[model samples]
Target: MSLFPTYKRFPLTIVSGSGTTVIDNKGKEYLDFVSGIGVCNLGHRPPHVQKALEEQLHNVWHVSNLYQIPIQNEAAELLTSTTNLDYVFFCNSGAEANEAAIKLARKHTFKEKILTFKQSFHGRTFATMSASGQEKVHQGFGTLLPTFEYLPYNDTKAVQDVQDDQVAAIMVEVIQGEGGVIQGNKEFMEAIEQKCRELGALFIIDEVQTGIGRTGKAFAYQHFGLDPDIITSAKGLGSGFPVGAMIGKEKLAETFSAGTHGSTFGGNPLASAAIKATLEVIFKPDFLQSVMEKGYFFQELLNEKIGSLSVVKEIRGHGLMTGIAIHTEALPVIDELRDHHLLAVPAGPFVVRLLPPLNVSYQEMKRAVEILAEVLDQITDKTINSD
Candidate 1:
């Protein structure tokens, strides 16, 4: 059988990657700003991660979850110690982590409904797909999982107006990575936590794309200083290795005991090794500070380079989770960027998503912006010529 025809795959075929750069089979060099859709926060095949994986390969790889794994414990410790989350349940992807979080919320609260926002994307699983607020994603899927509601994102008044006690959780992305890089309003985000407290509902932050220092913070929720009840994370957690985690406070620990939730390959020795190595690098105080510095530097460069474009609306995001909102189509702009040997992805109809590596140097950041400037010029020229 042939492979299923899915995903409007990009035309480029990558051969190998080093740091923030990749090579196509045609031997063309590209500065990868996609970061594997925010998975390679540390860039591809980082020396430390490669070394860690090699060491684990020489030892044991998979040991199942029947027995305790010290490396898993180490990985868990790194997360718990770093964030307000008291406990962690390892899974295999952002979707699994979100599914686990949903299960825990429903189980713990004994409630049926979840509250999400418009343009929010959790995952592709039945439950997560149902949780997503975008209609396009739910168009083809018949019989989605039940009990979900949507609110306008970053609207404090909408949050304040909530009167539903049936809301098991309020799941939100600090920065809607897939929703055109839409950011959460600080006041609204804070109000969500307060409302959750008043309603006795769980507060869930979907940090699948913003965690693991993608936002120059260990977790993007920390930026708002709101303490969520449950946080789902993946993508960059393992620095390109497949690993996810659902972190929660200690009070709900009893709800997920034993058989309620699990995964056979979630925290295997190999995955744990990848996580530990990634954490060791990004979790360093100096390293995170540097990320913060780099994030500002990148945004500043973009602002100075492309600020005058009429088609461009704005460049906004926290840390490296940046986006360029435009009046015209972003697809052509993204294609133009690719032609210039710079890789970027589209966030929404009018948004060009830019998720550079957290460790991408200021010089590389500047060059990427310069390349973007050239692409914008081409886009403008094309529009003029067509007219």
Candidate 2:
């Protein structure tokens, strides 16, 4: 028996992690800027989460959603309290959270079409994959779910060109993490929200990658000051535990009543335990303030160190969710960084994505910036010689 080869496996294999660092099977240590692709916001094996899980493990683990699961209700409450969204529907992953949002939009609006942005990534599920603007994800999967449209992300012109009653929802990412760290323009977001209102459409914000202090905010939607009818979250929701949530306004959430939606393993006791622990740490004003401060410092450091390199095109991001757009192929730099014991992932074609844990120290940020500078300097030197 063998596992499915769904991912393009990296060369390295990690054995364990503590704080913002991980050790590989070879006993080599690497600074984990990837943070499990933004899942370990509190870092690996956080004490609070560990204790919570242990306490829950001693109690019941799984139960029917039929009875009152106090912990499940508590997790939902924690999520709803963080954002403008009134209620929550728990699930297992970002894709599931997004799927729930899609279903809710259609049911609440009594409409079909869902509008998304070009280069945005929702998830890998059928509806979310169809909703994704990246065509590559849809390559082998023929016949996606119907009535989904893709428009230019952060394009105000697209906002002007809308038809009445044509869309059930206009889904967006405040910062398109998988789209090479493209940040949404303020005016652009305002336009989308206004358009959704004009067309009687739901505004859905996919914060799967940006939520839970990844961008120094409870939800990136909070940065825009625009209220969304629906917002989906996952990635860092449970500090690496597999948990997700689709949060929405009370009026819209009410449409998803008995038999309309349900999840078997979603919000089980163990998952809820992790959620409670993760939320307790991140929801604090001081913790989020520290993230905001560190994000500013990290972006400044990148500009100071790598801004002048010929291969560097731009650096864009808010808080810890940063991306560097380089001119040359990004793989060599990624490999070089790994060799230097720093781990970063790729976003789109030519960008290096940086998603350090929210609790990463200032000293760790300096180390990551130093490694990036060295690699980029070498690349620039090579390019100049070749030229």
Candidate 3:
């Protein structure tokens, strides 16, 4: 193979996609519940994002950050205007955004330590991988960058007991997407914010997998009435067009002055066009409300179909991001789903993660759940036969 074996890719090869369906190279169609691991929140090749990208292609694809780029300004304005943040630094992926947030937190507070929760995922870059709390991600890295402490998720007392004075920030995801689709406790989440205030540390929300209306809000943090000092966004920010942003409050604006940080392709015209268009669509009140309704309907369908199955453990999530925690390994279930012409992914060893398009139709959800029910039924039958 010419490329490095970084990903153990799925067996099927998808050639084209539209809306909630993807067609493989052999022309078989599947309901795409994975949504590119929550990156394609608006569905594949969404028309609004497509139009904006085409227009930008006619104008300009790239320009140096040194020059004035009006499209970048428009994209940044959309993010700042929608949230409590004042400034935005655009980048190319979630890892870059988190890296920028880390740099800003340390520079702004003059501190070295950061606190993240165990079972959390940040990204694959050196700094972001260090920020991630999962040890498996750090294995063989040979002495990762220090000063990061991993706390237990949803533990209010652990955050309350933080006594380190050199902590620069406490970074967390509202929903631990890669950590088995785990939701953060309201009391625990608030305590992190409060503890940051108590310790003079920046409150950072890593919205890489949950931002841009993924959870029926402009950002998932909005659901909890929490105002984060630094919000790192990617994944669905550009509707799968590869863009990330680091948003911060007004007070720390001067910390990242010129020559401090930048990306060559960050906020270029094409990326800016995609980000602006995607945000315009997802930020709409009606659209986000529809996502909420669909999520409720989807989860209800799953419960109605397979919630009681011996192999099924629980169904949980927020908005279009849902998970089915099964009693068995998630990979086998996911493979069976794919074989039945449906697609989902795994959040961990036991949680089957589902991230359908926000605009996925009701019928599509029903079909997905039916396929899931069938898959679980087969597993149940096999167990019964063996017993």
Candidate 4:
């Protein structure tokens, strides 16, 4: 194999997509609940973003960050205006954004330690991997970057007990996407902010998967009414285009002065255009409200259809980021969904994660739940037979 065996990829090779469905190499259409793992929040080839990208194609694609890009400013303005933030540092992916956040926190505070929650996923780079709290992600990568502590995710008491003087930042996710779609406890999230204030540490929210209307808001942190010092975004920022950003409050601006951090292709004209157009769509009040309504309907529909099943434990998540916690292994269920013309992914071992586009229709959600209920019932039958 020429490529690293990193992803246990599905056998289907999707050739094209529109809205909520993708056509595989065999011309078989499948409902796409994955949404490129929450990167395609606007769904495939959204018209607004596509138009912007097409227009950018005729103008320019890339330019170094040293030169001012007009669209980059527009994109940054959109981000800051939507949130209580002041500045944005564009990067290429979620990992880079988190990496920049880490660097800025340490530099601004002149401290070394960062506290992340257990089961959290930051990214794969050495620094980001160290920031991640999962052991499997750290396996075989000896001698990680230092001064990161993993505390229990929703344990308010654990956060209250942290009395470290060297903490530069306390980073967390409002909803732990890869950690089994676990939503952070409201009290715990507030306590984290309080602790950051108590320790004079930067409060960082990793909105990589939960941002861009995924949780029916521009950013998940908005749901908890907590102000964070730093926010990292990516996955859904560019509507499938590769882009990331680290947004921060004005007080911490000077710490990331010139030459402190940079990316070669960060916030290039093309990416900026994509980000601008995407924000123009997703940041609107009506669009975000629609996502909120859809999410409520989808979750309610799932519960009505599959909640009473023998294998189902619970269905949880905010907005379009739904997770179905099942008693059985999720891989087989995911495969069954794929076979039945639906596409969902696993959050961990037992939770099936569904990230349909923010614009997914009610009919599409009902269909997805129908397929899920059918597959889960079939799995339950097999389990009973085996027993």
Q: What is the TM-score of each candidate against the true structure?
A: 0.98, 0.98, 0.99, 0.99
Tens digit of per-residue lDDT, candidate 4, span 4-92 = 99999989999999999899999999999999999999899999999999999999888888887989999999999988899999999
Model 3: runs farther than 4 Å from truth? none
- Candidate 2 lDDT over 132-230, as tens digits, reads 999899999889888999899888988869885868999999999999999999999999999999999999999999999888889988988989999
Q: Across residues 76-126, which tens digit of lDDT does each residue of candidate 3 receive? A: 999988799999999999999999999999999999899999999999999
Give the per-residue lDDT digits (tens) of candidate 1, residues 129-206: 999999988998887777999999989999999998888899999999889898988999999999999889999999
User: Which should have the higher lDDT, number 1 or number 4?
Assistant: 4
Full-model lDDT for every candidate: 0.92, 0.92, 0.93, 0.94
Candidate 2: segments with Cα more than 4 A from true spot = none
Regions of candidate 4 where Cα sits further than 4 Å from its true position: none
Clashing pairs in 4: none
Clashing pairs in 2: none
**Candidate with maximal lDDT:** 4
lDDT of model 3 at position 363? 91
The alpha-carbon lDDT assigned to residue 215 of candidate 1 equals: 79
lDDT at residue 306 of model 1 (Cα atoms)? 89
Model 2, residue 387: displacement in angstroms? 1.2
- Give residue 75's error in model 1 in angstroms: 0.2
